[model samples]
Target chain A: MKHVIALDIGSTSTRAALIARDGTVLDHLRRASGHERGAQAVAECVLDFIAELRDRGLRKYGEAARGVGVAVPGAVDEGRGLALFSANLGWRDVPMRSLLSRPLRNLPVALGHDVRSAGLAEARLGAAQDKDRFLFLSLGDGIAGAVVTGGRIESGAHGFGGEFGHLRVRPGGRRCACGAVGCLETVASVPAIAEAWARASGDPTATAVHAARAAAYGAPRATRIWRQAVAAIADAVVAGIGLLDPRTVVVGGELAAVGDILFVPLRAAIAERLTFQAPPEVVPAALRDTASCQGVALLAWDLLAEAQR
Target chain B: MKHVIALDIGSTSTRAALIARDGTVLDHLRRASGHERGAQAVAECVLDFIAELRDRGLRKYGEAARGVGVAVPGAVDEGRGLALFSANLGWRDVPMRSLLSRPLRNLPVALGHDVRSAGLAEARLGAAQDKDRFLFLSLGDGIAGAVVTGGRIESGAHGFGGEFGHLRVRPGGRRCACGAVGCLETVASVPAIAEAWARASGDPTATAVHAARAAAYGAPRATRIWRQAVAAIADAVVAGIGLLDPRTVVVGGELAAVGDILFVPLRAAIAERLTFQAPPEVVPAALRDTASCQGVALLAWDLLAEAQR
Candidate 1:
């Protein structure tokens, strides 16, 4: 059985998986990324993970890995195989595909934006499988999105096609880390939500999970903070609907773990904001963390197929 | 010379042109659309316009029109040749292409959304000709838009992809005609600007042009009103860049005719709002009212080419 290696190089940690061509995860491993050391070290970390995964695949399957796929957080120029900029990885203009494939003899490498890879996974094997057009938004410590059209993610002219979280929802509301005032990220990100809740509830160490628990228990201050974050997210959704007219909106990330506390009011808020626009169905992400792994593996398999042709 | 009939079926009037195969307007005519009569009358008006254009082309140019293209303002299913809805035209689910093509003898007909057709024109021969990705926004008495990518307008899943004006920029600020609160249309449209200026200056008869003149002359009250409208439009641009990351933004319609009074400040405001997102070049529409006519003609030409293949 042929297999492909999918590497999800995240900010804090890296997840590597050996996936069969039929979309099954045969084996997977996770370890700290050591990105704090800088660009070269991060590249080394990804390279080491890929090397280990390839060796494991060769031993277990009696065949060398077919290809390798790397999904990273940031603005990526996929056509040029460059990871342009990633706040989390603290890297710029890193030639990801070339760097990762340098140590291998003839392994083909495919690189893509993390969220877009996950969106591809969702479109093929998860909740958005049937949706021809949808916006997949991941609200974690920060917010990001993937714009899927006609069963493929659009990389846009500059590969910034689906930066929904950077949308200015509250103009003059809060200063964002990206140097913009009142971006959706400033108000609705996981840390932002937790900080807002902590300030309002006078609990210095309150986490987003704590806020969600309190809100679920009908705590007024926690509820207010949650609603504010939901409203901000809803505003971004409404703006997204107007811009993309997606058939569905798939919400993922840690914030979505709050479940009904986030989605219930989000749906209501989006409904209220809509007029002539058709409101898309807002639902939670189905695949969770493994989405990028499967998606990139599929992408690697596609590359291998293309190479054969 | 062979020619095609391009008809722009707008709310108030219908404009038709006999366009040469090489993209020149050979002959043109315009008349009231008679939409106030009924949907059937509107359909007849389009048919009549096409017949006249075909006759003129045969008599003067010595060639019968090969095809017809109709651009209507609404949600159009271009594939099905259906004009799904138009608020100003007060029509719903009209099979425009089929109705118009019924009387013709094997003449292929194409239909498209008016703004999207105009956007196609801009992408091919107008302000956005050099831009591979751009948003064409027309701010008239009402606001509409077209999202052009790779030289074609993206008709989203529901054909509302570029409904930029409907975006909730103010959120609970003003009631839009679409029954939404704080939409960009309610704040920056020509009528909206005129109404705000009229209220502030206590001049009921003041139009958008008058407001522009007053603002240009440094009238304090008019300047304030103009700035407010510009700010709202800038906010919409900021949101657009975050979502589409287009290379350019083409401003059309009556409000864009205000010239530097709008563009000068709009540029500054957008520049201020932008951070990580690339600031797109905002320019005026070059083709003016002739855009839809030219664009539909192109579409008709494309249809003819396709049918031959």
Candidate 2:
């Protein structure tokens, strides 16, 4: 049974998985990212995760992995196998795939943008699995998206195709870390929601989960905060629907975990906002955290196939 | 010397052209669309325009024409050659290609959305001619865009890929014709600019050209109005840059005719808004009004090729 090592190198943690050729997950592990220790340290950590996955795959499957796929959260130059820049990981121009693959006897490596990789996985094996044109948005600490068309996520000219988080929903509303004003991330992301709830509820230690719970329990202040967040997200989704016209919009990450609490109002808001454009089915993501792991594994398999050809 | 007839069915007028296989325009004609007369009349006008171009092509090129392509302004289901809905033309469910083709001895007809067809032309023969990934925006009475990637316009799932005009740049700012608040079209389109300038200058009969001229001549009120329009346009461009990440952005239509007056300020505003996203080279459309005609011709040629294959 041929297998590939897939690693999702996130800012918080590095998750490694051994994916079989038949799209089954054999084993997986998670480790600290070491992102705070800077680029070189983070690269070493990713390599360590890859080595552990490889060893496990060899012992279990009795075959050295055919290839590896690494999904990085940043501006990735996938063709060049470089992690161009990531504010969260404190990395720039890191030759990610080369460095990670060098220690593994020069095995082939596939590097991809995290959201796009996740989108690919979703399109191939999750909620958007049967949809040809779809959008995958992960609303976590910050919001990012994957624009999938014809069963593939568009990487754009500069590998910046799916940066939906930065779409300015408010022209002069709030300043973002990216030096842009009124970015969608500043209004609808988990941190943004938490901060808004903290301000509204006058609770210094308020979190997004607390706000959701409070809103669910019919707290006025938390409801307003949650509604505001939902409105902003709906606004962004409306714009996305108009621009991309995806058949289905699959949302993942922490915010979507709230289920119907978020989706019901979101659908209504989007419905109110849209006129000429057809409203797409806004659904929750199928795969949770394991999406990137499986997605990158698919990319690795594709890379292996291309190398053989 | 096989040629194809291409027609751009605009609301006000239908422009027809005979295009050679080598992408040269042989002859062309324009006629007022009797859109108010009914969908049947409008279809007749389109057929007339095609017939005239075909005759011209036969007489001049001395060869039997290959096929016809029509670029329709509205919600079009290109696969079925159906003009699903069009606010400007006041029509719905018009089987445009079949209506015209049935009269032309059942010659193959290729139908496309006007903006997407124009984008295809731009990608192949206009300002974005050399770029693989680009965006073409025509900011006339209404704002429409073509998202060109890999030299092909993304028609999206419902052929609404590049509707950049509808992106909610200002949430709850101004009411749009599409029933959305703060759409880019409400702020940056030619008619919107004209209306704003009319209000600012207290000139009831003011138009976008008048505003451009007044701004160019340093009229304070018109300059302020024009600056506001430019700022809004820049905001939309910023969001577009973040989302599509095109290599180039080509601005066309009547507003683009103002040249440096529009581009200078627009470029500056976009530069100010962009952070991590690479600023695409913002340029004016070279073919101007002829883009859609040539673009539809290209689509016709493509259809001809596909039919032969």
Candidate 3:
């Protein structure tokens, strides 16, 4: 049973998984991805984490790991095996594959963007099964998205694609991290929802889960704020459907935790605006948080198989 | 040498062609369609137009047509080979395949939207050749678009997809036929451009072509209004890239006639807003007004070949 090791390096944590040829998770582990002091420390910690995973695998299944796949936060050159930029991890032009492969005794390594990896997971194993032409929206921190069409995550020509959060839904509404204004992330993203709820209800730590729970009993502020955020998301989704005509849309990240309370209004708003656009099947992501790690595992599987072929 | 008859029934006229196995037009003809009368008249006109084309084909290639392909504007049900709606042509719930097949010998008929046919044409022979992931935008009497990804046009779950021009770009700008406010067509489309130019220049009969010519020579109002329109288009394109991440964007219809005068600025606008969108090659549509007709011809080719297979 040939397999690949998948690693998703986030700002605060790292997720690792060993994926089998049949798309099953052989084993999985998680560890801290030291983001406190910047690039070098985090990179070294990641390399150690992956090495430890390999050691654990060797102890149990001995040389079963065919390769390793890593999902980074920012721009990456998977073909060139380089991390162009990772803002959260504070890395630039790091030869990630070389760093890990050299220490792992020349094992093959694949690298990809985090959202893209999650999109691959959705296409291969989740709600987008048996279909392509979809958008995998990662709605946390700041909103970013990955396009999956024909089983290929669309990487823009210049590695500047799927920046969905910067589409300026409100033109000049809110200041965003990307130096843009009123992006969907600013209003409809999970953090935005929490912030809006806090500002509206005078509770700074409000969240999507808290709002949904409150709205169940018809809390006025929670209902108003949540509906606004959901409608905003619907606007972005409608714009998405208009442009791409995706067959399915899978919403992931912290926003998905709100479950059907969010989905019910989201679906209605989308249906209302979808007069002439392709009405895609809006659904929740199945794999949850570790999806991108698993997806990156699939990338490693591809690399391993291609090397053999 | 089996073929399909593609009858593109539009508001003002009916066009029919005998498409060969390789998407070549063996022969074609055109005639006026119908008006305030009824769908029965329109159906009869379509029949007569096809008979004329069939006769012309015998005169030119000395052969009868095989299968059938038809592209109708409005909500098409390509899955069931039906036209669910056609506001312009006054068609609703029209069993187009059966009606058009009455002229032929009941050969197979594949139906799609007109812009989708153009997208198929671009995918096969035009600017989007060899590129499966792309979009075809047409600026005509009304604005509409089609999406081609992975060698297929997305007819959507209900056959209404790729309506970018209809997406609400402005929340409270203009009234659209679909009862939407400030759609892309209301600002950046041919009518939008012409209306903008007319209002800015105080000329009632000013056309988009006139506006482009003036803007090319550095007319102040023309430049201001045209730039706004171009900027709006760019904004929409950026959002599209965020969602679709297509590699090529083919612009068709009258506005493309301005050549670089239109494309150069439009490309710059799309480039400015992009962060990580697939580097889409923005170019004028290769096929002209007959692009969709040619796309239907490609479908005609595919349908006939599949029948033989």
Candidate 4:
């Protein structure tokens, strides 16, 4: 029974899974990412988690795991196996592959961007399955996107391709953390929506989910906030459609969990904004939280295949 | 001397060339496109031009031309060999390949978008030569762009990819011919700049060239209009850089001919707008008017290679 160890290191949580070649999760583990402790500590925690997952796979499957795939947030140099920069993790140019391979006895390691890895999973085994060209957007704490073409993710020349969140949808609108004004993330991301809803509704702790529910219940203020977010997202999506001409747009992350609340108005807004571009089908992601794990597992399998060749 | 007959059908003129496999123009011809006469007449003129170029190639090379590649404006269904629609040529769903092939005794015909083909030429033989990932932007009467990656153009799923001109830069601004408001084309295209310059300079005949020259000479009105156009163009290019992350941005078409006038401030504006993304080299195209013909010639050569395989 061939299997691989997959790990996804996000901002707050680290997820590990023993995945079979067919994308089934044989076992899973979760832990606090501890990114607040510092980058080195987080790296140590990741290594320990991978070791635990590998031991579990060996004990159950009675064989060694084929390879390890690690999906990290922020800019990555996949070809060089470096985690270039991650604001969430406070890391820069961490030699991830060498650091992992040393303790793992020279096991092959594959490194990829977390959002892009999830997009690969969606393209191959989830929402956009069998789609050769599509855009994968994750509307989470901050928005991120992946442009998949011909079954491969376009990482661009400098690993900055598909930076959808930074696209300026509203000129001179809001200041983003990335030092850009009027970025899509400043208006449509989960935190952005929550902040706007909280201010408008006078509920200091209101979340995006609360805003969606209020909008669904026909609250004018919440409806306006949700509608503005949806419109901004649609504007960015329309711009992406004009540039990429994708066949489908697979959206995931926290907001998509509300289903029709986010999708219904989103679809309508996109249709209203489109003029000459072809309309791409907008659908929810199927894999949910485990998408990055599954995607990284696929990367591990690819590494094994490459090693064989 | 193996060669191909390449024809570029623009709105005002049809240009033909006998091109060697190495991308050299062995011979060239030009005639009125006759698009004003109607779609049918334009199609006839294109076919006639191709036949004439084929005869010339045969006479000079002492052999039959291998294939024909036609570069047309507007939407193109390259896989189906159909010219889907062209606002300039006023044609829709023209069976370009069959029409040319039948008259030329079953010679293979390749159909391509004029802007995309020109981009291919720039990618392969012009300014972006040796660059595997780049964006080729033609700033003509209207702006158009092509995203070239891994030595191939991304035509998108619906053939509408690289519609850079239609990217919305100013929200709720002037309406575009494509029925969209605030498109980059409405503010930065050659005609757009020319119109603004004409109105501001109180000269109905003023063109973009005049605006560039006047701005160069420090004329206040022309400088203001030129700066506004450059700012809009920079905004759109910044968006493209965020999405595609190309290594180079090759600027072509009529406006690029202004040399330092367009490149100087345009480069400065892009530099000012970029934040986190990698800055791509902004350079002028080398092939000029012959780019589309040479690009279509490359397409013709590709078809021949495919047939041999």
Off by over 4 Å in 4: none
Clashes per model (N, Cα, C within 3 A): 0, 0, 10, 0
Model 2 is docked with a DockQ of 0.77
What docking grade applies to model 4?
A: high
User: Quick one: best TM-score, which candidate?
Assistant: 4
TM-scores for all candidates: the values are 0.95, 0.97, 0.87, 0.97
Q: What does DockQ give for each predicted structure? A: 0.71, 0.77, 0.38, 0.84
- Best first by TM-score, ranked: 4, 2, 1, 3
Interface alpha-carbon RMSD, every candidate: 1.4, 1.2, 3.1, 0.9
- Give the higher-lDDT candidate: 2 or 3: 2
lDDT of 2 by residue, B1-309 (tens): 888888888888888878877667777788898899988998877776666666777788788789888898877777788888888888888888888888888588889899888878878887887798888888998888887766656777776777888887776689998887788888888888888888988888999989988999999988888888888888777777777788889999899999999999999999988888878999999886778878888878888788789
Backbone clash total for model 2 is 0
Give the per-residue lDDT digits (tens) of candidate 2, residues A78-129.
7888888787887778898788777777688999888888888888888987
Candidate 1 lDDT tens digits, B106-163: 9999998888888888887788877878988988877888876665577778778788
- Please write out the lDDT profile of model 3 over residues A1-309, one tens digit for every residue: 466778888877788887776668888888888878766676678778777777777777776577888888877767777877766677778887787678778788888888888888888888888875788787787677777655667665445457677677787588876665678878877777777777877887777678767776799988887777777788888887776667888988887777888788889988987664557888998887778888888888788778888
Please provide, for model 3 over B1-309, each residue's C-alpha lDDT reduced to its tens digit, 9 standing for 90 to 100.
556677777878767777766666656667777745677777677667666666676666667766567788987877677888777877688887777666566556677788888888888888888885777888776777876655667666556677777777787688877777778888888877898899989999999988988999999999987887788777766666766656788888888888988899999988776643345889889887667677877776676667778
Which 10 consecutive residues of model 2 chain B have the lowest summed lDDT?
B147-156
lDDT of 4 by residue, A1-309 (tens): 689999999899999998899888888889999999877787788888877877788889998888999999888877888888787788888888887888788789999888899999998789998998999999999788898876778888887878889998988899988888999999889899999999999989999999999999999999999998899889988988887789999999989999999999999999888887779999999988889899988988988998899
* TM-score, chain B, predicted structure 3: 0.92
